[model samples]
Target chain A: MPLPTLAESAIIVGAEADDWRAAVRLAGRALFESGATLPGYSDEMIRMIDEHGPYVVIAPGLALAHARPGPDVLADGLAVVTLATPVVFGHPHNDPVSVVLGLAIKSAETHLETVAELANVFNDSSAISRLTTAASVAEIQEILGNAS
Target chain B: MKIVAICGSGIGSSGILKVNAERVLKRLELEADVTAAHLSSLSSDAADAQVILTSAEFVDAIGPTNADVIVIENYFDTEELARKLEAALG
Candidate 1:
């Protein structure tokens, strides 16, 4: 199935989050509102972060926050949040994340194929660069349209 | 084989590591089950992982684990680092 766009995922921005943690919280909220998260979703996601760091920095500006497909999801869906300014997750290769993609899957198996496909799309620099500069939901959606 | 790719956040750089490892593993004809995890969460899952892969900065976190730890740059380019991982696994 086709997933949501960056704008659809980016429900919170600089105005909402003072830092990356707050931004992740905001993204978590968006995911919850979209019916993607169950109870203890944030805790599991936070656990992943606490254990790992911000591991999903795809490019200079993009970060995809994901966890194991166990506790964080109420349903199977994906959420995205874009930052007005980059936020750091402390990953050495790229920090200051501008885009965050929240993924929640009902089962670990269901997520593998989609995540592998998403990884391929995210690997494209041109698509990532356009997403980084997009200023509005529509623009971001348009970028995803091209990328997807 | 089940391969666990680890990184600091398990978000940014590890994603690349996962992709690159998948590519190399594919080429090597290794039927692999690869997943990416943050270094913090690595402990619980490390017992069954055939190989533990990550980047240079976070290498210390692997600490005495049974899995062999291989560190590379965060980006997807694999020529140099892939060789290192291949050697270690052998």
Candidate 2:
């Protein structure tokens, strides 16, 4: 099955997040609000980072925060949160991320298409730049819609 | 040659690395098969790869392998990756 696109309700523009944890929370909140994930999903993401490291900061200015699929994931979901001020993930590379893309997958094998599409979007420098400056959820949706 | 990109989950950051690696390989005129796998699966998945590219954090987790492991500081920079691939594959 094809992965879902960036939901309008799951897009947070100009979000106020003081640190990476707050940024991830803002992104995870969108997923929860959209009924894609259960509560505590955000905390789990942070915990994973703390245990593993900052590998989630996939690109120079972007992060794709996620935890393992479990009861917390109601369905496969994607959320995008653009921070008003970029926060550092303490990564030697890809620090001070301005956008966080939260993902909730039902299973690892089921979300390859979604992750591939997301990687394509992120690989495009212009798309990442536009996403960073996107003013509203509608704008972000339009950008993603156009990409698809 | 076979190459694999690895990450903690294999679906997230490693996917990005895999894409970048493909681009770099194409530009370098190198012929290789590239795959992405989770850190947990690297022991089995990386056994056949000639090279394994991933973040520095996973170097120790990957342990000792026959493949030449390259620690990429930046996954987004395909130019640097191309250079490194040339150096490794040439």
Candidate 3:
């Protein structure tokens, strides 16, 4: 499960603003509007974020938000967003997040391997840059393909 | 060693906690079979586990866990958690 396999270019965006909540909402919009999500996904995602405060900030600017798959996951896939400017989600040590990775797994088990792959991906400096600057979906896919 | 991670649902945060716990145990050079399950099924699961790791909310979620419950605020802090688990198991 490479990042691009789960990441779609259509969802990527460049941000110039500073509000992190808006950034999350921006990512949420991509998830919802792209028809990449199941019904009620946007609300569930917002609720989960409001409660958890970006629980999966794997590194400084990288955050992965995943909610339980009840009625939110339209497919057995994922939706992603790369922030144009970094925004803070109120994490204790790390303040700003530049890339928001939203995942909707149809089943709890479907994401295990992807999560493991993400763990390794988040550890690299160069790889994160490639993903952060990825301008198109094919480029994003290429990043994942080259990550190995 | 058999380890059981009990949480509200068998699949959400508890599942991530289970993954971190396994990573910690592995780092500590301990061999253990780990499983994450909902609080509702604790009795059967607790019967075989050598160690039980859970959050502070155990009191409300499933009454009191019968095994040595290691209360942790966040499961992702592997270093502190590994140390806590080592002490509990020791």
Highest TM-score against the true fold, candidate: 2
For each candidate, what TM-score against the reference? Answer: 0.71, 0.89, 0.65
Q: Tell me the tens digit of each residue's lDDT in model 1 across A26-135.
A: 66777887778864666676676776555555446666666666655667666667777677878777777777767766764445455555656664557666666667
Candidate 3 at B62: error in angstroms? Answer: 11
Candidate 1, superposed: residue stretches over 4 Å from native: A1-16, A56-59, A145-148, B7-20, B27-50, B55-58, B65-68, B72-90
What are the DockQ scores of the candidates, in order? 0.27, 0.54, 0.18
lDDT of 2 by residue, B1-90 (tens): 999998887776787778778877887788899898888888788988999998877888889888888888766777778888888888
Order of quality (TM-score)? 2, 1, 3
Please, what is the whole-model Cα lDDT of each candidate in the order they appear?
0.64, 0.82, 0.62
lDDT of 2 by residue, A1-148 (tens): 3447566678899989988999999988999998899878998888878878988886788888988888888988989899889999998878889889898888877676776667566656677789899998888887666433
How well is each residue in A5-82 modelled by candidate 3, as lDDT tens digits? 444533675655467656656666666665667546656766665754454454556665656667666764445677
Docking class of 3: incorrect
Ranking by lDDT: 2, 1, 3
Write candidate 3's Cα lDDT for B1-90 as tens digits: 788876554454455567777778788888888877656678888787777776554645455555677765544456657888899887
Which ten contiguous residues of candidate 3 chain A have the minimum total lDDT? A1-10
Candidate 2 residue-wise lDDT at B68: 86
